[model samples]
Target: MGATKIDRARVADTALRLLNEVGLEGLTLRAIARELDVKAPALYWHFKDKQALLDEMATEMLRRMAAETAGPAPEDWRRGLADAMSALRSHLLRYRDGAKVYSGTHYTDTSYAEPMERHLRMLVDGGFTPGTAARAWFTAYSYTIGYVIEEQAMGPDPSALPSGAEAAANPPADPAPYDLGARATRLAGHPLAVAAGEELFTRHDPGFRAGLAAVVEGIAATLHPDGAKRGESGP
Candidate 1:
């Protein structure tokens, strides 16, 4: 293929596919080139290095998220924030190690601008000052990223736990290690700690939504004490 034929989008697409196959650690310029039926040098023409390619892949992921979630902004600021966050979580969960891939990469591409502007506008119109709106966005974004990272680390079945009988029969060789059961016992006397431990060890979706709701409520309290009653006019 000609140099002009290899674009950043193509490279990003290949990298995303490779992400599912070999995961983030195995995704490399050489591997992408091999999948593309091109030499490693050919990929360099598009991306300067692996980080550059990874950035584009992250950008592509966001672009897809924007496309998938595109719609009329919800009139309710809380609803708008919830919808955006839900969309973000869904997209991040689509690929293996996707949260790790997207956590810190900056998208230099302009395609992220429209969705970003829309999200900010949603908050700003909902009675948040421009500064507060930006902060709210970042706060919610951080929560979503962190939640997904932990969720991914726990694997697909968040409820998978050793039974009490199983644990008693086969105790760990090293008792001092971080054990969920032990940790739960330590927090048993504290209601809040027990609730948090339940949320952490059990299903993550409800907990994620609950946490997002709390974040939104806190932001609303800070920016609009009246809960932005009239802030749902437009976006």
Candidate 2:
């Protein structure tokens, strides 16, 4: 492929596909160029550096996420917030190290702006101040991204074990099963740590939902104390 034939979309698409094969650390510009069958210099025409390509990849991920998450906006702000965060988590999990690709990267397009505006407006309509609404979104976004990053690092399993590329990169010093009893025995020196291991390591799906609910509830109580009364006035 020549420089003229290669566009940002193709480069980003190729990068996303390579993510599953190489993981983020192994995903280099030269590697992407190899997949594209072009010289590494050819990619520079579309993206100046690896971060530039990552930003485009993240932007493309969000674009597909938005396209797939179609529905009537929930009338309740809490539901809207939770739904948005859940959707983001599911989207990030679709690719390997997806949250890593997305985190701290600049967007290549304004496509995210409109949906963000709507979410913030949803919070504001539910009686949160504009600043509070923005903060709430950031809080939830940060939590979801951080959670998925850790989750992916441990692979798709609920155990402390790493799988796939993660395992290949950093094998565990002492590999263990997904057994809570064994995990507790290993952490016996720290009683609290032992006690928490079960909840921390297993049942990730329920744990994530519970934590997200707490975050949403905390935002309501702390940022919008009069939210109930004010929300009653909303359509």
Candidate 3:
């Protein structure tokens, strides 16, 4: 027989399931304990409070994300970095509100270090300065989080423009007043975006990949100083 487990990992897994089912707003120690068929105080033996549980879940998710992107590649640091962000975007979409879980969270934890270190080293090998590499990481990382949040906010639907057809059919007739900020750059002179603009308004992998590529390319332009010559060239 397999040895019985003692650590709180199982409780964390169960709670994450609850999070997926109900969402962050509904996750609680008492609810998770009920899901696991254990009393609430039993959970206390493992986690001190809700924040502790959220931390554990966040760590687990990051570990999985890191594992998905680690590997050898001869192409260049940019492809590797892009692949890493793609994996993150894909995995987060698997769960409701996953982007929110990862945004601005602590990444200095030793567990999250290996993947980050690898990416930074790869960037350096590709001729990026340390400060540039760090900044690129930040830019790409924030883009992933921000993009995924917008992806989640857009429910799955035809109106969520994956092809520009929707936007063409439903262009806001007038320059409408958007709330304080707009998620997409007002689609005005962008062609690939115009030709395939629907992706911008939808929850999709292609759109996510395109946006991440744009952020990474933006970082490349910042680092190399000449990459900017081709600004707004489809990332």
Error of 1 at 33 (Å): 1.5
* Candidate 2 weakest ten by summed lDDT: 154-163
What's the lDDT for all of these models? Answer: 0.79, 0.84, 0.69
Best by lDDT: 2
Model 1 per-residue lDDT tens digits across residues 1-235: 4543677888899888778777778888999888888889988888898888878889999889888888778878789988899989978877767899998888958988898888889888887888888988899999999988887765542123243798579742321223667777888877787656655766677788899999988878666635554455433
- Stretch of 10 with least lDDT, candidate 1: 171-180
Top candidate on TM-score is: 2
Candidate 1 vs candidate 2, TM-score winner: 2
TM-score between model 3 and native: 0.72
Off by over 4 Å in 1: 1-5, 157-197, 225-235
lDDT per residue, candidate 2, 1-235, as tens digits? 4354788899999899888877899999999889988889988888888888899999999899888876556769999999999999978876889999999999999989878888888888887889989999999999999988877776642233466899789865421236878877887789998878767776667778999999998788667847555566775
| Residue 126 error, candidate 2, Å | 1.0
lDDT of 3 at 101: 67
lDDT (0-100) at residue 193 of candidate 1? 78
